[model samples]
Target chain A: MSASPNQATDSDRSEVTAGIAAVLHPAARGAAREVPDAPPRGRTAWSLLGLSGIGFGLLAVSIVVSVRIGTSGVSYGDLGRSLGSRLGVAEPLPRLLDSLIWDLRVPRVLMAAVVGALLAVCGAVLQAVTRNALADPYLLGVSHGASTGAVLVVVLAIGAGSLGVTGGAFVGALVSFGLLMLLLRRSGLDSVRVVLTGVVVGQLFAAVTSLVLMASGDADATRAITYWLLGSMASARWGVVIVCAIVAALGLAVVWWYSAALDAFSFGADTAASLGINVRRTRIMLLVVTALLTSVAVASVGAIGFVGLIVPHGVRFLVGPLHRALLPFAALAGAVFLVWTDALARVSFAPQEVPVGVFTALIGVPLFLFVLRRRGEL
Target chain B: MRITVEDLSWAVSGTGILCDIDANVTSGETVGLIGPNGSGKSSLLRCIAGLRAPTSGAIRYETSDIHGWSARQIAQYVAFVEQALDSDSDLRVADVVALGRTPFRDRWRGLSHTDRAIIDAALAQVGLADLRSRGWKTLSGGERQRAHIARALAQQPWGIVLDEPTNHLDVRHQLELMRLLTDTDQTVLIALHDLSLAARFCDRLLLLHRGTLVATGPPEDVLTPDRLRDVFEVDAEIGQDSLGHLTVAYRGTA
Candidate 1:
């Protein structure tokens, strides 16, 4: 039963798996997991749902705690005024409530949540797009680059004021992103290469920052740079909080819209292309959005570490690689995580606040270790 | 749909892969291409599917050159299942099959009911209707392969391309998968290492050696002892099965 070339099929494909049965060798000598029907599907779904629910629950708790934080203080009328208004309690049981709700507590909570969600969402998308578990926004040197720019404005008086620091940080982020593209084009944007390059660049900028600090004669400027390096939400006025939230929301929307493309990417570049995805274009878009999210978040929070690297990995164990599911869960989890971390930072030493980034790093490293051990990847 | 490959040559990383080759395949027909390792079998297949561009040839589908065609455009006529056994995440069997319809989907639209129905039919065709809801990563190797084949089938392409789809399947599934294609409307292009299997089922054969076309004819003409020794460097016994189909048995080295 043969036909001429003219009668052959249009596909003209080769390597047909015509006749080979891989016997399920119950004892294939060294088989890790049997290939058929090994892992439970329902359990994964159930766990993802449960974890998301808990995430929301955590967000609620965080919001409540953030509102209550300034209630105990005597100097702050903000919390008490807001609490009195909320409870319909008699008159002014201390006006700490109004100040807390309007100026410090509420705005700080929102900024932390916005930064955390931005980081976590970007992290989740990055990991999926690059097909690596360790991908994060800061893997491109944006964080350190921003830091160098902000440090210059603070310690070297290059900007000579607060406004210049933010603008310089934004410009620094753009320049580093461009440098990353130029230096790493040949290898095809590998996740490991990008992250390692970022680390190297980060050290270079760290040296620059050190040089500036050592040369500075102003103690107050040096202290400001030091505090900023540590990262905090203490400076989140309502205006800054609004900007952070807007950026995070817009960035998250872009990521959410491209979730389908992200899902396709996990299968490999060739497969995704065969499915009609413009892989290169989509990747470029993802990189841009994540960078925007990173710059805005870093600018607001002054380089809070660990949230971006750690939250998405924790969420992935529960959710798998579907970006639509992974992203929302990661966002909620991140907000909750940063909220609690920020709260702990504020309350740990009481009047003397710890830098939230320090607390996040200290707690994040162990959790990260535990997750790695659980995954057997260590 | 009909495809014509005219004087095709392919180069990769400055190395020649496929040199001066030509072939044709029609819609709703079953054909086979047989070759040894590194004979550019996969590369040729990729070029046909528009997944890769040939250095000096045009693969035309339905009279349209696939040279500059997007993967999505070519996908409408051809669905390719690669040789690798792979599954990511805990996606269900049905979900994997439905992914084949991605190219057919409007940019922002969700899966249509027709898409789901086609996926269901594909699952049924592969004898996995009962397992449609099963998670992909949990399936047996054979089952996973079937699931991918089903996915290609769901795309409703004019022909389906299989790249060593039977590498991991045992004899039973091997027969089942081959048999599954017998009555289908979609044409089949399969690359096989086993000459006997190719002889028993393939309607036509296109044989390659050293990235060049060595022979093209009936299994009887193509699977001869002389050609086997010349191209594959193996001595083999060729005969007829009780079903009057060509059958081959490898004897030894050339």
Candidate 2:
């Protein structure tokens, strides 16, 4: 079989050589000189800026529309008045409507956007670092680790009185990420090994979470654990929203700063290193940032799936794969996507809210399939 | 810049890939590295490019030891082109070539006008100026090879190290690429399998066998029939063509 292929290539080589020789001949020079004109310079930059502007515009619209959606019959006018009153620019809204928007709806919508942006950026960075399109925060099992900690607090009441489920989840995420780093260090930080180790470690943490929940005899605690696992923004508070938003912003900044290096990585680690990038240091740093962002997000709102897996892929189709353009657009599109998903979670069934994670998967699975089909990968 | 490899050796796992390899590449010289497959040509190039650290000995660029220099610092003076160029991105040809400026530009800054000019000149040199906007995935195999050469040219380095750069090119492109390298004043160390092309274009040839330097000299001295049989396992007749270019005709495996 190898000999036949070699014979075929030998024949092909002669034909190709003849063709190339013809191209190099003086008679063909004029024709070759008449080649296609260069594409207009700065076109990519203009398109990226234009697309980013559209993304931000869509995000603004999504926020406004999502905030107006709920069980209450509060009008946009009332929500505006409430926001204006808080900013000291208008008359105070009716006490009921003001507290409803100020204390509950606004923070929930903001947290949803922040978490979405964080997950999407993490997904982009992880995909670049690992050179695997399937990579995401969940791929590393940080969410499962966070779930284990949350379950321990919610079901077993371990640390519930002090650190609480949120605090416990954060710690769990850090521990899992730390363990992953240690294992990867020993395994030479190959992407495949990192992914495989994550799967094993993630499964172990998830089993522990289930074991804790099963051991708890309290039916109420079991129900709470199940609800949290499916994920929701219903428990979002101002403090959680503020902390998550800050962390997400910082993560975005760090990822954006490394966008060029990320573009080099799309070729592969060796190629990136050949381009003078410090591949080992850059990969480790990106892993740390993505893990941190994922931990903070999962801690705030249970393990929300799909946003991290699908958002970067979706954004890449629209703006191509350069990270400088992909990162910002992914963040904006992700923010808008989750805000609407959270809105659907609130109103899809009316009164009895479904977990926002369910809605994201409902939307994400079809979108992912569509993208794969379009790319001809499926 | 002159690159001096003094008693250099590299090992992978427990086995040596390169052993006590000594060679000197003076500025403005084109040196051909010729050997059978697995003779450590690529490994030697990687070490010189600072993509790999030698297990022992030293590589010096002019007066400075390259091992102590950062990858970025080394890249500013030396550009490397590996045999394989695989990119999963949809970046355009110009964008790929502009990546050569990575060592010079700030991480956050866009390419300046001078960078753009250098990229255009490099593209023109490789006759790919027309394809600057073409997607990298859309290029033919020969065109892709030229684009990579263009990228190395855009680096504007004092020295270049290429591993099997002509592997996929047609005969015309292979000759043209060698001519381009010979025309330049920069120091070059190119790994090649085509002995005739090496003999024609290189100022010096370094032959390796089993991780050791077997010969290093002008083509006439390095391409002797005895050495070819012993190192490459090929029985061949060597002579000069009408244009005074050295030619090799192989009869059979040794």
User: Which 10 consecutive residues of model 2 chain B have the lowest summed lDDT?
Assistant: B68-77
TM-score of each: 0.82, 0.90
Against the correct fold, how does model 1 do in TM-score? 0.82
What lDDT does the true structure give each of the candidates? 0.74, 0.83
lDDT of 2 by residue, A1-378 (tens): 011112123235334323433332222234334543343567768877788788888888889889899987768888889988879999998787788898989999999999999889899888888888898878788999998888777765666442398998998888888888888886777788878998988998999888887787778878877788788999898988999988888889998988888987766766677777888888888889999999999988888989988999998889878787789888988899999999999998999999999999999999999997886667
Per-residue lDDT tens digits for candidate 1, residues A1-378, read 122223222244211111101211111112212223223355656777787778788898787776556424423354555656667873654445466565687788888888889889988887777777777778767887787778777765665455677777777777777777677677666556766766777677778777877787678878877787778988787887788788888888888878767766655776676776776777778888898788887777788888888998887666755676778888998898888888888888888888999998999999999977875567
Candidate 1 regions exceeding 4 Å error are A1-61, A70-97, A160-162, A190-230, A314-320, A361-378, B106-109, B242-245
Write the residue-wise lDDT of candidate 1 on B171-220 in tens digits.
88887777777557567888888787887778888898888888887788
- lDDT for each residue of candidate 2 in B116-169, tens digit (9 for 90 to 100): 666776787778888988988889877788787777877766678999888878
Every model's DockQ:
0.14, 0.15
Clashes of 2: 0
